[model samples]
Target: MTSTDTSDTSVLDDPVGESLRGRHAPLGRTLGRAAAYAQDVATFSAVPADPTAADWSDLARLLGPGAFADMFSCPALPPAGWEPVFVLEGRQMVWPDGGRPDPEPAATGPDVTELGKADVPEMLDLVALTRPGPFRPRTRELGTYLGVREGGRLVAMAGERLRPAGWTEISAVCVVPELRGRGHAGRLIGALVTRVLARGERPFLHVAEANTKAIALYERLGFASRKEVTFRGYTTP
Candidate 1:
């Protein structure tokens, strides 16, 4: 298993290569090449440095003709044949001790509930309203998602994203604009963390570097920043 944080090599030297290679290997679209990613290109894209032209070819063939992203753990110059759709920078945080954190003495609001496949429509609508991240129809298959509903409307949610080997990513954590400070996000995160720990896995997540509010929240909740990663978007010629 690759460490959540690495300093043994330059990020450009390995980038997200190890984690992609080790944890999400089964979800990979290509083999025998340094680049790998989840089966869902719409969800995420990543490339290790120094991918051969053939590696790109295999990924392109899997992706077919369209626009998608290629998120590198470290920022580097774009490859020759691909068009740069956009570039993003963010921080990856992790809770290494299997998501265990000091228990909060406060009570979880009654509106909070565990969500399943039956909740996809409401989940997508909330995702559309909040734009937390790329949440597709099947993204929920990654793991459990918890939410807080108000008047039968899903208002806040937090759920798993990437599942490498021993860790599960807590992602798409969002709350409606009107419900910002009532601890809805915290409630959902706590619920998810509990679930991750119960299953013998740790929790991790990503957030834009500029999103200090969320960063502070995660920090307060005992998550530590692991690395600064660049999310690169790519498109075919």
Candidate 2:
């Protein structure tokens, strides 16, 4: 097996590469390489491969349906009521070169800032403003969350999730409907990406296949989709 120099922290210093590192690190070296290679092959079809269906099935059984449905569908196949059981997607790992220009810092609003643990109640309320699925009040414990507050009411927020060793997945990004189109989302992403870089980790994220607008935004932020993987599962009764 090829060895990765885990001690090499260069990738974690650049904003782009740092984000990828956070997402890739926690999976550990071996599993991270395996997952990346599998995604590459599955997407390009240059190599013939059949990943074990059981693996997906097991994850589906574990994560349940509501969460799974956001990513994929089982296509009316098997077990009569089989739902999407897993979510999978691919990202092109980006490394910053000297020639790459740094993104201009986002303009901040008076109310936008890093969130504190004391803000948990309001944070849940802000998350409710967006209606992301299966979010529990306690989900705040998952990772660092940042938010924008208006007169002390949490209005917009985004944060990290699904942390692997060197990589962290950016999830739970949203702003109130009334606040949309004001570049709040971009600012939140920029700030969160900055935090991820400071931690010596890389950042990555997943989006629904059909969300063209979100995909476009990520691309503008220097993320490129490298492969596609289906997330399959069903809702629990």
Candidate 3:
């Protein structure tokens, strides 16, 4: 589902609007214009069976030149006249099997607990330590973030990103290098997904195209790739 312009004034007249409203009805009629544009915004999902030069041009216009490479999914080789500075391939993993999985049934440890705003500073540190992306100080404010603390230190964390219509993206998933393979990432995701389902919305996530290990983990968790997409960030020249 794609839309070209924002001229569709009425909420009923816009597909993006309809999709967003249908998915996030609980959010009520308070949809912000930024949210609406964000709903319509797509990078790799816009790839047509036979994309044209105009399509690339329009995509460039929508994303601008300063876009991040991880923000978009494009063909291995872009069409002529379209030169992508960088491309990141990722999959939009959807939970075909509804309902959150049982919450691990037991806690990993007393130190492994969910975090709140008070943990933001430590969460940001974990993100930096893991180097997930260009995380800002306020990024944690984007959604409900959960973490596991070991000895009162934040060691692993995961949280939400990109809210397109009914879909809630689970991103910024990272665990301290020392805590790798400890299932902390999974636990955080599981708990967070539980919250998303409780709100009656679906959960989805993205991973770098080259990340086969993470993909396998997600698949094991009942998430399947719906389609390949890209996250591209741009900057004005």
lDDT of 2 by residue, 176-227 (tens): 8987767777777777777766666556676776667778877787666644
Give model 2's TM-score versus the native structure.
0.60
Q: Candidate 3, which ten residues in sequence have the lowest lDDT sum?
A: 28-37
Residue 217's C-alpha lDDT in candidate 3?
76
Q: Is candidate 2 or candidate 3 better by lDDT?
A: 3
In model 2, which range of ten residues has the least summed lDDT?
A: 39-48
Structural similarity to truth (TM-score) of each candidate: 0.81, 0.60, 0.65
| Top TM-score hit | 1
Q: What is the lDDT of residue 144 in candidate 1?
A: 74
How well does candidate 3 match the true structure, expressed as C-alpha RMSD? Answer: 8.1
Error of 2 at 166 (Å): 0.5
- List the candidates ranked by TM-score, beginning with the highest: 1, 3, 2
Residue 86 lDDT in model 3? 50
Which residue segments of model 3 deviate by more than 4 Å? 1-85, 103-107, 111-114
| Model 1 misplacement above 4 A | 1-42, 48-50, 72-78, 96-99, 103-107
Tell how far residue 93 is off in model 3, in angstroms.
0.2
Residue 6 of model 2 has an lDDT of 30
